[model samples]
Target chain A: MLGSEIPVFMTNRNTITEQYPKIYLYRRIVQAKLFIDANYADNIDLDNISDEAYFSKFHFIRLFKNIYGKTPHQYLIAVRIDRAMQLLKSDKPVSDTCYAVGFESLSSFSGLFKRIVGITPSIYLMQQQKIKAQIKSSPLTFVPGCFAEKNGWLKNRNFRETKS
Target chain B: MLTKMTHISINVLDQDSAFDFYTNKLGFKVVVDVPMGADGRWLTVSPPDQPGFEIILTPVIRSMYSKETSETLRELIVKGSFGVGIFTCKDIFATYEELKAKGVEFTKPPTKEFYGTEAIFKDDSGNWFSLAQLT
Candidate 1:
């Protein structure tokens, strides 16, 4: 009797499992995202990433977007742009930063950066430079020093009073 | 004239996971689970004792949002930027223990506030809700 019921139980379990297949798909999508995060700087592609997650490219794209709310390419671009923002904050040039962030062309990089970040790479660099300059030029209001007379605080106070 | 709300929507990161979180973990009942479009589902759930009201678990997908908007909303949701609303129970402590035992992640355990005894737990998509037993 138990042996006869085994296939029936398996069929019922499979039916229930089919009702919530997205949970398994969601795990595959997460694996794809982990791959993207680790290798965003490399020349990643749909075929390779999908293969890594053991999914077809078409199904992977739909499942990934459904689960993550962003397509794999969009997520990759977001990651690349984020890294580009950090690189651009330093002395890196826009052209070099573009390629360094995994974009093959400068124009496409600039276009995507503008669309997502609301500014072109050059403009972002200019803003970063302006921020850096402002921070550099701001006056220092406090300095650490000993307050004891031997450390010159009293002498400085006296000098200030005499000047005033 | 529109005095009572019968349905509300909560944007979630994933509909399937949200369904599991709401129904299994939070002890809500599935109200509806229908296909919305090719890539989306119209999923809703209700609290155990709340019969009429349903909370739709809407996925933040690109069909209803641009790429940038979807990205921004997903980021915010993952960062716990949206607090969906409040749910009330008769015994806050008991409900909290029950939900916690069911694997619900609570940001704030049950504590006595000025208004009531409240706890905070986030949905699967990172939107938080306050569970309170008011005085």
Candidate 2:
């Protein structure tokens, strides 16, 4: 039987594959990187980057996708999803984890989480707990800084550390 | 209040240059080129598929008054410190290559986004355009 309560939080994985140099897209990417860095959790708009880039809501979406290669909302949601993933491994509740990463709709959050991770949040939670326990029992050694991390380049990886 | 984006207008420094650049380099369909009132203005183009999306091939009024506004605007575009960006593309990579080959100057080369490959290029008069891979 499934556990009495579903644990929250999923794992995190950033650094979406980029196949080109940033010289041409530096400005727009920087703007997006800034927005994502600052408001990946809070609501952010194109204008938030620079007045020159902002338009109406839809325009902003189009502009962001055109410049950044991903819709702002999609990118931001993915950030939260990645953060939730790590939290899941650490014993956070799925629903609470969802909100902590900025998702307000539980149903939507669950659906998207499953889509990205290939299983329902509940199932993933159970599997992660099992893995965590197994790993704890297994004898392992590591160097001073093993650097077991994902998207560590973002530096904001700390986003999940202080998250409730 | 809500309708699919039918068109957009951009101010240019020279109508003739804008016309040739957009039509020849960008391949926008030229739907009309009628003259307006005395001091009569002329020149316009539309996307072949969406004839309604008209681009106003008019000179920036400031350029006509003095070069100061033109210089300021040019600097802003260079710094990416101007207005909203217009992204036009079907397959952003191919279009990016095509424009890049046409001697277009770009702020950056194409890069992959979760949305698609994207690039930024500027017109002769310093108007910025973000070309996205058409999806």
Candidate 3:
């Protein structure tokens, strides 16, 4: 009676579907990535991230690094630093941005920021602010020369002149 | 006589997501988007400026492949085993910045390679591509 309830075509497909397909592995890896993206601000580690995909820690590390070109730890640090950069650009204080982006201490945050970004967070913040002010003062100077020249607008204004 | 190659096939996990990634994210134009019964769609797209060459976004579907084979192929894809192709842009830094701002994940940022200035980024389905500006 239970068998008769299924359509003939559905019954045939169900036999194939019953196999534990390997093709679904990509979905699990992607799910793990999505988990990282959503939880990057939280204090997460290799074990926590790997468990999201149902893979063992070592295997997950290898698989993640192979696909993403970085270990899970490295990728997590990059994500945190990227978020910190954005926060600093928005005028967030250096100390605040450290904790905001999941870094535990200002000293470590500043040190790591310098290592990856080539400048301390405070200096980077100041640089962004300066660039923003410059852009506001002379917007045309920021436009690509090719774009300005193609539109024939360069004939009217010299970007080099505006900079001074 | 065979004149030139016109199409390249790419294995995508999902055709619909690949469509959005190729068109909206990469700015490619669609060449064909037609249903193919249960196997999925015959979807192909080309670079915005280069309209002649097409990249087929072939989906690995249950109807077309044995469950075991699909599993193997999907595992390969997620492992970043495929380097689909190289795309050229006029300004490597500018293009790199633009694509990054649009949520493209770059495994290696723009670095000066012997062939040219190159950067590598992965698509939505975990297939990596070399984005370069040749010298």
Candidate 4:
């Protein structure tokens, strides 16, 4: 017990341990985000998500918003809308894509999708189809301007040469 | 003569989550956890049963790094750009399952390789490591 009483370093403060609770709390919040990412297709709500993070609904909302810049409900909607956009781009029908992304009703899905993405799912799908068709007809137009220019394939094309 | 390496440093975005991940999920034991104040924490953990070698869970903070550097490092960590090291286990399948059950994220399942059976997993902050069972 020679060195035990002195406590080598002054001020018995293990600062890192003091911050462990905050760190573990952050891990739980991140865990909730990962849960949403993995189960966005399921019928997940604030209750399920908050429970997943082991936080109460109100506190979880505040913590999630502070970290992600959006409330839990908003984040879930954004995630659903983001996935819906990807599915719609792949030519999935709007109704199927809506249900697939966990929206119960087509109307609510379209409304939320338009509010977030600035276009209806059907319109977005049509736009994606149009772009795909254009790409198919003239793939060079879709290539990066610098890439085309570097390959000397832009000599006769009317591409408004984007500045590198 | 340097007979063995003592510590390896891992850059983490958040020391708190990194600590939880290393201690709770990975089951590493904390060897040293001292706060360096503005310079962040001097935190190190050793793998279970490996008491000598330590893995320093260094936090990337503004005091220790410039704003641009910290931002870049944070992005890189989240993008899983770094593969820190390899850890060996007695049985890769059992270890993988146990870690998986604890919510550890495995980027690749246990797969057969020419050298050994390996599985890749990422820590909470996005730094990945290879877990292998050498044959």
Show where candidate 1 strays beyond 4 Å. Answer: A1-164
* TM-score of every candidate relative to the true structure: 0.44, 0.40, 0.47, 0.47
Q: Alpha carbon lDDT of residue B130, candidate 2?
A: 72
lDDT tens digits, residue span B76-121, model 1: 9999999989999875654665566557888987665657667889
What does the lDDT read for residue B40 in candidate 3? 57
Number of clashing pairs per prediction, in order? 0, 24, 2, 1
Candidate 4: stretches off by over 4 Å: A1-21, A152-164, B1-135
**Cα shift from native, residue A104, model 1 (Å):** 68
Top candidate (lDDT) = 4
Q: Write the per-residue lDDT of candidate 3 for residues B1-135, one digit (tens) a residue.
A: 989987787989988999989976786877655443344555678996798998978776534467887788889998999998899986565456556656999997766655666788999989999998798
Give the DockQ (2 decimals) of all models: 0.02, 0.01, 0.03, 0.03
Candidate 1 yields a Cα-based lDDT of 0.72
The DockQ-based CAPRI class assigned to model 1 is incorrect
The residue pairs in collision within model 3 are: A22-B71, A23-B71
- Decoy 2 TM-score against native: 0.40
Give per-residue CA lDDT, model 4, range A114-144, as digits (tens): 9988988999999989876664455455444
Docking class of 3: incorrect
lDDT of 4 by residue, B1-135 (tens): 779997787999889889999986786877655433344455788997699998878777634467898899999999999999999986565466567767888887776665667788999999999998798
lDDT of 2 by residue, B1-135 (tens): 796764455767667777778876776766544332221243567764467777656565421435687566556655666444655655454455456556788786765555555677787677777776644
lDDT of each: 0.72, 0.59, 0.73, 0.75
